[model samples]
Target: MENEDIWPPKCPECGSPKVDYERQSEYTGGGYADYWDEFQCRKCEFTWRSDKKTSYF
Candidate 1:
């Protein structure tokens, strides 16, 4: 695995940098509530979720 693969989340089917953030949701019913972010690939139309929250503060 290269450094780029270990960093940004890429489409598993097609490797493309044309990725877009879909939306964000909060899960409060789980054990530990967390904010998740959704992403989609413009080239392949692949979608994925990430739990790494971002703080603007």
Candidate 2:
């Protein structure tokens, strides 16, 4: 679970602090109705979605 209070979440694959965060949209019901918190590690290029219940957008 990633917390918004925590900046630069560590990469789960590489454990690097050099990470980027973004709120992405997903296709749902034939439209972009769903959103997700995306995290990418700049160091290792590892990517994952936040498991937090709170939505970013």
Candidate 3:
């Protein structure tokens, strides 16, 4: 399960409006970094950070 507090409404990288939740890996038994809310930028290829500060956004 994922905590809502750890997700971001927008991407902090390129500041694009295009953002969504995604899994880093599709394979099972993956590490923590394998599962995260990925943000896609429409203007650039910059992705959001999955760190602690991401929740603050």
lDDT of 3 by residue, 5-49 (tens): 644455566666566656554334333223344666666767664
Better of 1 and 3 by lDDT: 1
Top TM-score hit: 2
Model 3 lDDT at residue 11: 54
Best-performing candidate as measured by lDDT = 2
Candidate 2 wrongly placed segments (more than 4 Å): 1-5, 26-33, 52-57
Compared with the true structure, what per-residue lDDT tens digits does model 2 show for residues 1-57? Answer: 857676757788988988989987654554335666889899889889976443333
| Structural similarity to truth (TM-score) of each candidate | 0.55, 0.57, 0.37
- Which TM-score value belongs to model 3? 0.37
Error of 3 at 55 (Å): 18
Candidate 1 per-residue C-alpha lDDT over 1-57 given as tens digits, one digit per residue, 9 for 90 to 100: 558544457776698877887556455553544566687899989888876664432
Candidate lDDT (C-alpha), each: 0.69, 0.74, 0.52
Question: Candidate 1: minimum summed lDDT over ten consecutive residues — where?
Answer: 25-34
Worst 10 residues of 3 by lDDT: 48-57
